[model samples]
Target: MNFSEIKLVVIDIDGTLLDNDRRLHPETMRVIEEVQKQGITVTLASGRTFISTARIARQLKIKAPIIAHGGAYIARVTDDEPLYEAPMDMNEARELVALLEASGYYVKVYIRDELYVQVVTEETLEFCSQHGIYYRVVGSGNLSELDKNPLKIVVIDTPQGINHVYKLLEPWKTKFNICRDTDRGVEIVKRNVNKGTAMEKVCAMLKVEKNQVMAFGNEGNDLDLIKNAGLGVAMGNAYAELKKYAAIVTRSNEDLGVAYVLEKYLLKNLN
Candidate 1:
């Protein structure tokens, strides 16, 4: 493919841009700036909250819309208004909370744009700290205080515990979109929400075509975004399933894989 033909490059955080140590490589940021200088738009598509994603976007100096909440919400960094929001319905949120509670998994419910933890455990707190995420404690007795409207619900636990929660919620998969945000946790959003759908909205707003966009990712959740992009570049350390969906595969995140791919395919092709 001709990289010069590409107009937008959407990159995922975590495994795609940040190394396993959770730090963004300085080289990757430089390559992103190079691509922008070529008149190609660069944006972030992440499972992180808007607040978290915006911090990196600002550092990268990106002024475009961001696909956040695993594609459930898309908005520009300079504007608070969301171009699209696929929040989980109140009934669905309540039902999911009841089911997770019945299954005995300590979960965090995100409602009213706040993260509420059922019971703060050491592991959960560690996960939040490691990922630089913020949360508030709300014990079982305060479950009623969970926002009536929630964007999503997340269950944080060991891999085995999270697998158990997934099984327990299997019956409702058709009604909700369940995904593992990390090895230690799973996130549940509305069934219709996904990165691909959110990217499509951003493309429409920019008058860009799917054939003119490239995306990079390294997770199961990034599958749709990869499949939807004109050229899907997978990190070498990405899951095998996700790699299969990509048109090209580059080095692991720690090796500045995203930067390598952009330079080889996008930058090298530019005049």
Candidate 2:
């Protein structure tokens, strides 16, 4: 495939572009900038909130709108109004929240940009702090009132706890899209709202075809996007299942996986 023919590059943040330290590799950022210089659009799609993803978009100076909350929301970096959103049903979200809390896990709900939590655990606090996400402690507060419409719910716990919750949520999987976004947490979104669907919407807005796009990811939540992209590049650190679905498996994130693929495949002509 001709790299120049690719019009858009959609990247996942956590395990694709960012290393374990949650920071973008300098070489990767440089390659991304180089691609944009060639008139290709580069955007982010993540299981994170728009507010958080937008910050990175701004730092990268990419104009393409970001897909956040695991594709439940898509918005421009400068605006709060979402171009597209699939919020969870309030009643259903409440039921799931109850089940999560009952499982002794801290739950974080996304109502647009704000994150609402009834109680902040060490892991939750660390996550928020590391990502620069502002969270509200709505202790003993009505979740419905705080955010009647939620885009996604993040259940924070140990790996074992998340595994247990995953099993309990298996039945509701038909109703809600549930996947482990990290080793210690699971992200729950409305059914059928995911990276692939969001990528389609983004392509529509850009007048780009699916065959003209490239995507990279490293987790279960990213499976849809990986399968749908014209070129799906999985990181060396990606889950085995995710790797199987990718068109190509690159180096690990810490080894500058994003940059490696860009230079070797997408940016070869430029080099």
Candidate 3:
């Protein structure tokens, strides 16, 4: 497909745009700016927090809506009011917390406006410090408080442990969607929240057709977006499942894959 026909380009950050060093390539930024100049709307759909996603959006100078928290939240880059949100129900949130705690995993609950951690473990504390995630530490004494509402539940653990948790919660898969972020962190959100759903909302708001959209991603969580977009571009280093869903495959993030695709497909065709 000729990417020039795409009016909106949705990209994932961690593994699609940023290299292993967690830095955006200069070429990628150039291509994004060129695409914007061509009047194509460029936005990010990621599993990251708005605060973190905003940093990259600012660097790319993207002014469109961003789908964050794996689509549980969608907000305009310059607006404070969320365009859409699909937070987990209170009971589901509590059950998730209980399950993680019982499995000996550290958990953090993300509410619409705040972040809550039942008890901060050494690993979780270090991860927060390194990632600059805003969070509050609530010891075991505050477990009862978890009955409050939540947007999603984030669990930090090894890949194996995460897989185990996924299996244990398999029965609830229909009620909630589970995904692993770039940091290997697992998250559970309301069933309706996902990159594809958020993209659909943004497209509707903009009056853009799905056939006019292009997307790039690199993880299992990105599968829906990739499969749904007209042109689903997968990073060469993307997960096997994600790559299978991609309509086209490009170089890895470190190789400036996003930029390569833009220039070769979107930019060149625009002119």
Candidate 4:
């Protein structure tokens, strides 16, 4: 890939940028700043909600529009308004939320900037805390009364738990898209919405060509984003499915994979 021709670099937040422990390496931070100084646009793209993604964007001092809610919501870090959004059909969301609740899966729904939960588990609390997402308890009865459609619904649980819930939703596969956000969590969005579509929108807004973008990710949710980018990188710890689509595989996030690539591939070509 021609690094000099790239103008945008999209980084996934959880498994790709932060280590399993949820810590951002100093070397990673330093390299990000260095790349920005050289005139590349760096943005955070993830399955997180806007409120959650914005906190990390603030910490990184990124002014770019962030891709959140598994690419269903894209918003500027500085404002509440979205650059783009594709919410699930209200009836579909209500039906899926009900099914997940019936199956005893912990479900969180993103409605605009707010998050609503059917039940708060320890897993829910930890996820909210990790992403700085604030949520309120809204049982099934109250969910239907909400005025807006949900950006997406996330089921948080152990791998087996999520898998069990995933199986129960098999009938809806033709209607909604379901994918794993993490080993323990599953995200559901409208069929046509995903990171790649969102990336296409972002590229259009930025007036950059698809061949001028670079992306880093490590899971199924990141597949399309990786495929559409000019140069796609997979973290060393990436899922096997994702690694197949990446042009390069870097060190694990814990090992500063992001930093290593920036220095060797990105920054080296800036001069």
Candidate 5:
């Protein structure tokens, strides 16, 4: 594909854009600004909350709409009401929480932008420490205690824990979107809420064609986004399952992979 046809750049946060320490590379930041000046829109799509994703966009100083909560939410870079949202059915969310707790896995419930847990466990702390997320302790048994429905739910444990939860939720897949977000984490959202679905809406709102989008991602949750984009870039650190679907594989996150490709292609356009 000719990279010059690209009009929108959709990026994932945790593994696609951020470094190992969860920070942006200066060169990456510079390249993004340059892309925007070239009339290309750079947007973020992540399993993270709208608040957290917005925080990253702010640091990048962008004002574009973002897909957050694994595509359960789409809004401008603010706390404003979403352009679109698909909250999980309350009963199903509670049931999944119960099943995960019964199986001895830690569950995180995301309502709008707030993260809640019965209590912070070692797994929760370790996961948050890696990404610098702040959460609240609900001090309850499960999501049954909350009257509000969540936009997304996350289960954290070993990679084996991912398979266990997948089997446990297999019957519920008809009602929710389930995918492994990391080696030790599985992300859940309402059915049809993955980034590919969200990207459709984003493309419409931005008035861009599917053949003009260039996306970058790293995890299993990113599968659909990678599959459907015009140019899907998988990081070298991405899983084999995801890499096979990429148009091309780039350097790893630690090596500023996203910026490397953009600078090469977008710069070529300049000269």
Candidate 6:
């Protein structure tokens, strides 16, 4: 494959770009900078909220729009307006949130780039601390009068708990794009929305074709992202299922997986 033809790079955050400890590897950071300097547009495509993704983009000095909310929301790093979006229906979001909360699951709602929760947990605090962001607690635990519609909903629990919820929401499978993005998390977005469709919107805005894009991911939510890219590279730590769609499988995130590929395939071309 002529990787030189790739003009855009979209990377997933959690397990593919961030090491297990949830930190960006120095080599990964350096390689990203180098690739950008080489005139290749590199940006993030993550299941994180716009605010969280923007935080990382700032760290990387990436000015491009980020695909956030697992493809439900997309906006530039510094812009308040969306380049493209598919926010969920407020009625549907509120009902689902109520059910999940009533079931004792830790639920977080994202609306217009901010995180909204009824209560803060050890898990939420630890996650926010690592990402350097805070959550907004709805004063009355009411999302009815929020300023914006929700972009996505997240449920965090034990892996077994996640399965229980998955089965519970099975009837909603046709109503929304529900996914098991992590061992302890289930992500919900509007139907027909996923990272690949979101990337297509980004490509459309940038005038880049699908075959000109390079994407990287390590989970089920990333399946379409990996399949759509001209060069979809899966991390060694990725699930066996995700690896199947990748054009190539790189090292594990802890081993500077992304940088390994960039150094060998893309950066070496600079010579």
Clashing residue pairs in candidate 5, if any? none
Residue by residue across 138-255, what tens digits does model 2's lDDT show? 8744453554789998877789988988998999998899999878889999999999999999999999999888899999899999999988989999999999988889999999
- What local lDDT does model 1 show for residue 202? 88
Clashing pairs in 6: none
Clashing pairs in 4: none
Q: Which stretches in model 6 have alpha-carbon errors above 4 Å?
A: 139-148
Please identify which of the two predictions, 2 or 3, would achieve the higher TM-score against the true structure. Answer: 2
* TM-score result, candidate 6: 0.93
Whichever of 1 and 6 has more lDDT, that candidate is 6
Query: Each candidate's TM vs. the true structure?
Result: 0.93, 0.94, 0.93, 0.94, 0.94, 0.93
Q: Between 3 and 5, whose lDDT is larger?
A: 5
Per-residue lDDT tens digits for candidate 3, residues 1-271, read 6565799999998888899888888878988998999999999998777777777898999998998888889998798879887877777667667767776777777765456777667766665664557778788635435756676777777788878777887888888998776445777788967898889889998899987999999987798898889889999999888888888899999899999988888877878
lDDT of 4 at 24: 83
Candidate 4 lDDT: 0.85
Off by over 4 Å in 4: 140-147
State each candidate's clash count: 0, 0, 0, 0, 0, 0
- For candidate 1, the per-residue lDDT at 75 reads 83
For all candidates in order, the CA lDDT equals: 0.83, 0.87, 0.82, 0.85, 0.87, 0.87
- TM-score of decoy 3: 0.93
Model 1 spans > 4 angstroms off: 123-134, 141-145
Winner by TM-score between candidate 4 and candidate 2: 2
